[model samples]
Target: MEWVYIENISEYEGKEVEIKGWLYNKRSGGKLFFLLVRDGTGIIQAVVVKGEVDEKTFNLCEELTQESSLIVRGKINADRRAPGGFEIQVKEIELVHLAKDYPITPKPHGITFLLDLRHLWLRSRKQQAILRIRHEVIRALRDYYDERGFVLIDAPIFTPSACEGTTTLFETQYFGTSAYLTQSGQLYEEAGAMAFGKVYCFGPTFRAEKSKTRRHLTEFWMLEPEVAYYDLDDNMDLAEDCISYVVQRVLDRKKEELKIIERDTSKLEKVVKPFPKISYTEAVNILKKNGIEFEWGNDFGGKDETIISNQFEKPVFVHRFPAAIKAFYMKRDPLDEKLALGCDLLAPEGYGEIIGGGQREDSLEILEKRIKEHNLPREAFEWYFDLRKYGSVPHSGFGIGLERVVAWICGLSHLREAIPFPRTIYRLSP
Candidate 1:
C-alpha cells in the first residue's frame, strides 16, 4: 500500500493507502463505524464496517477515543457529502497510542481556558486556520520586498540603546553592563540601508509596555524597510503597495483558511492599491466634526485611529503629524518646521495602525540638537550621528507589525490569535 496524506487522498481513489494521523472524532451505527481523522494537512472520514474488516479491527474501533494516534490503511472512496469530497474504507488499523481522557473535547471552551491550554489548543481547527493564514501573510510580505530589490538584513536582539524611546525599553543586566531588548529594528536598518542602498529587517522585537489592550504584545515580529534616497512620499507609496500585495496574496491563496475563520472575504478583496491619504490636520478636523475631542499634538489612540480609518474603504494614511508627538529622528517638514514628515497607516474595520514610517533627519547638527532637546543621552547615539557627519542622503523607512496585519486580514478580534505563541503583558507561558 502507498503512504499518503489526508489532503491528497483524492488522487488515490479506489486504491489502498496508509494514513498516519490521529482520530478527530467518531460515530457508530451498529456494525458500521465512521471515524474522522486529521493529518494536520486536512481531515477525512474513515469507514470501518464489521462485515468487511475482522472482528478484532471492529473491536479496536469501538475503543478509539478522540485524538487517539493511529495508522490506518484504507481504500479511498468519493463521497460528495464528505469533507474534501473524499472518504476512506478502512482495511486495517494499527494503534500507535490510545489517548485517554483528552482535556479538549468537542464542546466549546472559554478564551482564558483555551489560552491556558494553548500548547494543545493549537491542534484545534480554528487555531490551525489562523496560523496558516499568518504563514501566508509573512510569505507575501517577504516576497513583496524581495521582488522590489530590498536586501534582507537581520538585526540584533540586544541593543545598547532604545530605538523609539526609553519608556518602553526592556531593561536587563548584560554581563555587568545594562542593556535592552530592541523595540524596533528601524535604527539598525537605517545603517543597513546606507550600506546596501535598500534593505529590510524582519525579526522579533520586544517592548516592555504594560498595555493590556487587544493590540498590545510584549514581544512581536516587525518588518522594517529602509531606503537611502526615498522621501516621505516615496515611503508612503512603498507601504501602500506592500500592504495591498500582502492582502491580495492572502485572499488568493488562503481562501479556505479565511473561510474556516469566518473572515469577510469581500472586505479583504476591497483592499486594493491607492489607499486614501489624509493629513493629520484633516484627521483632527474630521474627529472634531464628529464631536470627538482630541488634542492637536497628541498621538492618536486605538479609538481615534478606528474612527479615522472607518471613513475610508481601505487602509488610510494619516501623515504630517506634529514633531512634538513623533520620534526625534523624523525629518521636519520644510513647509512647516513643527510638523514631522511621518505617516501612520490605519487599517479599516477598527484594526488601527499597522504601519508607521517617516523621512529621517539627515543633518547631524539638527539631530544632535533634537537629542539634547528630548533629554536623551547623546553618547549612546554617537555612531548614529556619525552616519550624517561622514556622508548621508535623504532616506525613509516604515515598520509593520506582523500580528496586527494578520489580525486585520483574518478579521480576528484580538492580535493574540495571529501569532502561534503570543507573549502579552500578563500571559507568557505556552
Candidate 2:
C-alpha cells in the first residue's frame, strides 16, 4: 500500500492509500463510524462501515479514542460536503497507540485551562491553522530578503550589554560575568551590513518587561534587516516593500488557513506598495483632532499607534520622532537636531508597530556622546563603537516582530496564540 498524507489525498482520489495520523474526532450512526483524522498537513474524515469490514475491524474502530495514533488504509473519495472536500473509505486499521482519556475534550474550555494544556492544545484545528500561517510568514520574509541580495547573518542571543536599554534586559550569569539576552539584533546586524553590504538576522529575542498587555510577550522572534548606504527615506521604502511582499505571499499561499482563522482579508488585500506615510508631528496633530491628548515629544503608545493606523487603509509609517525618546543609536534628523530619523510601521485594524527602524548614527563623536547621555556603560560598547571608528558608511535597518505580524494576520485576540510556547510575565510551562 502507498503511504500518503491527508493533504495529498486529493491527488490519490479513487485509489487506496495508507495514512498514519491521530484521530481528531469521531461520530457513530448505526453501523457507520465517521472518524475525523488529522496528520498535521490537513484533516479528513474516514468512514468505516460495519457491513463492509470484518467484525474485528469494525470492533477496532469502536475502540479508537480521541488522539489515538493509527494507520488507516482507505480509498480516497471526493465529497463536496466533507472537510477538505474529500473523505476516505477506510478498509484496514492498524492501531499504533490508544490515547486514554485525552484531557482536552470537544467541550468549550476556559482560556487559562486551555493555556495550561497548550502542549496538547496545539493539536487542535484552529491552532494548527495559525501556526501554518506563521510558517508561511517566516518563509515569505526569508524569500523577500534572499531574493533582494541580502545575506543571512545569525546574531548572538547572549550579549555583553543591552541593545535598547538596561531596564528591559534579561540579565544572566555567564562564567561569573553578568550577561543579558538580546533584545534586538539591530546592533549586530549593523556590523554584518558593513561587511556584507546587505544582511538580515532572524532569531528569538527576550525582553524582561513586566507588561501584561495583549500585545506583549516576554520572549518572541524578531527579523532584522540591515543595509549599508541606506538613508531614512530608503529605509522607509524598503520597509514598505518588504512588508507588502510578505503580506502578499500570505494572501496567496495561506488562503485556506486565513479562512480557518476567520480573518477579514479585505484590509489585507489593500496591503500593497506605497503605503501611506506621515511624520510624527502630523500623527500627533491628528490624534489631538480626534480628542486624544498626546504630547508632541512623547513616544507613541499602543493606543496611539492604533489610532494612527486606523486613519489609513493599509500599514502606515509614522516617522521622525523626538531624538530623546528613541534609542541612542538612531541618527538625528539633519534638518532638525531634536528629531531622530526613525519610523514605526503600524499595521492597520489595531495591530500596532510591527516594524521599527531608523538610520544609525555613523559619527563616532555623536555616538559616544549619545552613549554617555543615556548613561549606558561605555566600556561594554567598545566593540560596537569600533565600527564607527573604522570605515563606516551610512547604514539603516529595521526589526519586525514575527509573532505580532502573525497575530495581526491571523486576527488573534492575544499575542500568546501566535507562538507555539509563549513565555509571558506570569506564566511559563509546557
Candidate 3:
C-alpha cells in the first residue's frame, strides 16, 4: 500500500491508497452509500458497500456528516459517473474529529449570512476561485514590472503627511506621533522615481469613505508606478499594457478556475490595448451629446464615467480635466490654464476609474504653491519637496486599485467578493 494524494483519478486507479482528508458531504441509499471527500487537491466520491465491510467499518463511515475530518484507507479506481470522474473504494475508515453541524449549508445562503461566516465560507468553490484569481493577477503584475527592470519600492504605510485631503485618512498614534494611513502610493513612488529612474509600489492602502456603495472599500491594495524622464503619455502606455497583460494572463492559465467561477470570458478577451482616448473638453462634449447636463468646473461623477465608458468598444481614457476639479499636484496645461495634464481610465461595462494618473509638476516653486494652496502641512513633506529642489526630471505615475480591476476582469458585481477578507466602511472581520 502507498500513501497517495488524489488530484486526477487516472493516476491512482486500481491501487490501494492511504487517504487522510475531511469528509465534505455524504449521501445514503439504505444498505449502499456514496461519501464525497476532499484532500485539498480536489474532491472525489467514496463508494461504501454495507456487507463488503464489517459492522464497525460500516458504522464508522455511515454516520459521517459534512465537514467531518477523517482518515480512510481505500482502493483508488475510475468511475465515469463520479462528479470529478473518479471514485474511491473504502476498505477501512477512522475518525479524526467529527466536525459538528455546519452553520452554513450547501443551499443558497444570504449575503449577510455568508459574510458573517467568512472564515468557513472561504472554503466554497466560488470564493476559492476568486481569491486564487486575485493571486494570479498580483503575480502577473509583479512579473510585468520586474521584466521591465522597474525597481520595486515599498511605500510607508504610516506617514506624517497626507495626499490630497485629511478628512479621508485614518489617523492613529505612531510612537507618540500622529501618523495617517496612506491613501495612494503615487507621491511616494514619485520620490523613488527621482532616485531610481523607474519604480513601483504594491501594498495595502486605506481610505475612510463613508459611502455604502458596491465599489467602495476602506482598505484595499494599490499598484502604483512612477518613472522619471517620462510624461503623461508614458504613464498612459504603461497603464494600458500592464492592465491588458494581467487580464490575458489570467485567461490563459486559469481557464478551469474561471469556468468554475462562471466568469464571462468574451468581455475579458476584448480588453486588449489601444484604448480610446478623449480630452476633458471632448469628454464633456460627448456627455452633453448624451443628454448629460453638468458644469465644466465640476469633477465627473459616476453617471459621467458610465456615459464615457459606454461609448467606446473597450476602456477609454478621459484626459486633461479642469485643474480646479483635480489634485493640485498635476501639471497645468500651458495652452489652457484651467486644464491639468491628468487622465482617468474607465473600465468597460461601466466599471468606473480603473486608473488615475497624471504628469507631476517638477518646478519647485509651482509644486510648493500648489501644496500650500491646498492647505497641506509643508513641514511634514519637506523631504518630498526636496526632490523638486534637486534635478527633478518630468515624472509621471498612476494608481490602479487591485480589487476594482479584479472585479471588472472577473465580471463580478460587488467588489467585496474580489478579496478574501474585504475591509469595507462597516465590516472588518473574518
- Provide the TM-score for each candidate, comma-separated: 0.98, 0.98, 0.94
> Alpha carbon lDDT of residue 118, candidate 3?
89
Q: 297-353 in candidate 1: lDDT tens per residue?
A: 888888898899989989999999999989999999999998999999999999999
lDDT of 3 by residue, 323-394 (tens): 987887899988888899998899989889988898998888998899889888888678878899889789
Pairs clashing within candidate 1: none
The C-alpha RMSD of each candidate to the native structure, in angstroms, is 1.0, 1.1, 1.9
Better of 1 and 3 by lDDT: 1
Which digits, one per residue and each the tens of the lDDT, describe model 2 over residues 248-276? 99999999899988999988999999999
Better of 2 and 3 by TM-score: 2
Alpha-carbon shift of residue 317 in model 2 (angstroms): 0.4
lDDT of 2 at 391: 95
- Residue 56 C-alpha lDDT in model 2: 82
Clashing pairs in 3: none
* Residue 196 in candidate 3, Cα distance off native in Å: 1.5
- The whole-model C-alpha lDDT of candidate 2 against the native structure comes to 0.92
Enumerate residue pairs that collide in model 2: none
